[model samples]
Target: MLLGGLLGGALDLLYAFGFAASRGVAPTRLLQTIASGLQGQAAYEGGTASAALGLFSHFAMSLAWAAGFALLASRVGWLRQRPAFAGPLYGIVVFLAMRCVVLPLSAYPHPVGFPPLSTSLDLLSHMFLFGLPIALLVARALRR
Candidate 1:
């Protein structure tokens, strides 16, 4: 679980950095800005403690998602048989569920500017960034 969480969080952060780089944004600065924005603060403090906490939080959330799928796969015969595909499928379903149900219900943070493009990029990022790593990990684990 620790390994999977670390791997997933690393993948997510790397993708986020790449995405920021593509937009000519410094990854660290972008993250700080986002963090400050979420906190409704004027400036970011750049605290290592906060950063570590954030990473752990992200990792735990990812691990929870993966574990949930593992539990479901254990019970569902079809999912157990198609372990390779199950992860990606679970990722897609989770993404859609979050977008359609969770996000809409929660007053959580979301992108503000670049409406359609931002949302599209977000969706694409989640699909590949989050989905791909989990998929690969699950596939590899099943094969072992």
Candidate 2:
């Protein structure tokens, strides 16, 4: 779980940072945006403190996701059996949950919309970088 969380969190952050950079967004601002989920518009005012919180919140969420998958995979044999398929599917689920449910419930200030290009990239990153790593790691752990 620890490994999955660290790896997935790092990968996800990297992707987010890279994507933000391509759009002329600074990494700190990106982190602040994440912090906005919890702190709302105040996150932008809090600077590094809020950015740190965002980073911590991101990793904590990654760990939670990893732990959740690990727990489910432990009980469901097939999840451990087919990491590739299950991982991507789980990514989609995570994407939906975050975009649909989690964001709406949080202090996020922006309206949620599935704009095609960004949405596609986000989904792919979650699948290939986030969920895939957690699923693969969990499957490997179970084999031991």
Candidate 3:
């Protein structure tokens, strides 16, 4: 699970950085935005320390997600029956969990909204880059 978390989190963060870079947003700024999820708007005004907190927060989330999948896979026999399909499906579930549950419960106000296209792209990326890799890697480990 740790291995999956590291690989998947790194891949997801890289994609985030790349996407932000293309938009002329510095990577640290993006990380700070992530930190803002926890620290509120103060994260934006803060310096490298806030960005570092965001990086740590991101990996912690990844590990939690991976550990969740691992726990489910272990308890539910059906999940192990079709890892290929389950992994992608789980990705969507993860996306919803973040968008709906995590965000709303965060320091921010209730209900979440973002630009339509950006939300769509983020959901897709979470499914493919974050959730999929974690599920697939855990599935591989289970087989061993």
Give the winner by lDDT.
Answer: 2
TM-score of each: 0.65, 0.98, 0.90
Best by TM-score: 2
Which runs in model 1 stand beyond 4 Å of their true positions? 29-46, 97-118, 139-144
Candidate 3 clashes: the total is 0
Query: CA lDDT of each candidate?
Result: 0.59, 0.93, 0.83
State the displacement of the C-alpha of residue 44, model 2, in Å, after optimal TM-score superposition: 0.2
What would the per-residue lDDT of candidate 2 be over residues 24-140, giving only the tens digit for each residue? Answer: 999999999999999999999998999999999999999999999999999999999999888888888888999999999999989999999999999999999999999999999
Full-model lDDT, candidate 2: 0.93
Candidate 2 vs 3: which has more lDDT: 2
- Model 3, which residues run further than 4 Å from truth? 109-111
For model 3, give the 10-residue run with minimal summed lDDT.
106-115
Ranking by lDDT: 2, 3, 1
What lDDT score is found at residue 132 in candidate 2? 94
lDDT of 1 at 68: 68
lDDT for 55 in candidate 3 is 99
